[model samples]
Target chain A: DTAVSQTPKYLVTQMGNDKSIKCEQNLGHDTMYWYKQDSKKFLKIMFSYNNKELIINETVPNRFSPKSPDKAHLNLHINSLELGDSAVYFCASSQDTDGGTEAFFGQGTRLTVV
Target chain B: SQELEQSPQSLIVQEGKNLTINCTSSKTLYGLYWYKQKYGEGLIFLMMLQKGGEEKSHEKITAKLDEKKQQSSLHITASQPSHAGIYLCGADSSNAGKSTFGDGTTLTVKP
Candidate 1:
């Protein structure tokens, strides 16, 4: 079984459209995170949730919202997608609550806005 | 914001050669992590070093954290083509444990 799994491995959407990526982990982790990797391959944390509570939220735009339905799921929903939002989105999970925890990542979902 | 600098941007070497990649932080790090990503893929956890002077190894890959807790190095010995990928170093920042990754190190190994 996949430890962390994400739906829509590839997404192509028009600008101004709304899209959502679903993530689920069977590892029974307490923390989930959403990261975006740009064309330069720089990975940045967009949002993090611990035990269904919002934790670390970087300087991401308000258009990007992360929702944790439970301890095993974290989903990313973007309103009015932009070309700038075209990148690889990753969903990861960690068993720990704080720093210094090893994370398991999903294969990744490539988002392309036309 | 905590900035992380990594180098060299890209590397190519013959198989069986040794290579090293570095990640440094502008601010002190609470913990450091090493991840690998194949082309167009998500980051894969390799290892994590928390305390200063901490060292961890898996197979032919080994990572070391500087005593100052400001820098880290990922070294690969007897490298193979399978080791070719982008290696990223991330840190748990002071403000939060948020992970900020460097640009990346794209590695290519030839037979």
Candidate 2:
């Protein structure tokens, strides 16, 4: 079974169009995260939720909002997307909030804004 | 804020040749992770190191953490085309599971 999965493996949209990406993890983890990988392949943490509680919120713009309905799901919604929003979004999950554990990542969603 | 810097942004090596990638951190790391990412795919966890001066090997890849906990290195022996991908090092300094990653090193293995 796929431990982590994200829907819409690829997405292409125009500027000002809003879109959402869904992520789910079946590893029975207590922490989930959202990351953004730019054209340079630099991965940055955007948000993290532990047991449905927001634990880490980087300096990401308000346009990017992450919602975790429960411990197993974390979804990202972008509002009024801009051209700069083009990047690959990844979903990850770990056993807990500890940094010593390895994180399982889902196949990323490639989002392109024109 | 913690930052990880990976050296040799990209590498090209012939098949059977060995290569090493280094990751340095700005502060003491509580945990370090090594991951590989194939083109157009997600990051795959390779190994994790928590203690200083510790080394772990999987298959042909081995990772080591420095005694200062401020640096780590990943070495691959007899690399093959199937090993080509971006190698990323992540550091957790705050123990919050918020890993900070370095710009990956792109490895290209020639046949």
Q: Which one is best on TM-score?
A: 2
Q: Candidate 2, which CAPRI tier?
A: high
For each candidate, what TM-score against the reference? 0.95, 0.98
The fnat of each candidate, in order, is 0.75, 0.91
CAPRI classification of candidate 1: medium
Per-residue C-alpha lDDT of model 2 across residues A5-110, encoded as one tens digit per residue: 9998999999999899999999999999999999988999999999999999999999999999999999999999999999999999999987798999999999
lDDT of 1: 0.90
DockQ versus reference, model 2: 0.86
Cα lDDT tens digits, model 2, B19-89, are: 99999997999999999999888999999999999999999999999999999999999999999999999
DockQ for all models, in order?
0.71, 0.86
Candidate 1 lDDT over residue span B1-111, tens digit each: 438999899999899999999999878888898999998666788999999999999999999999999999999999999999999898887655577888899999999
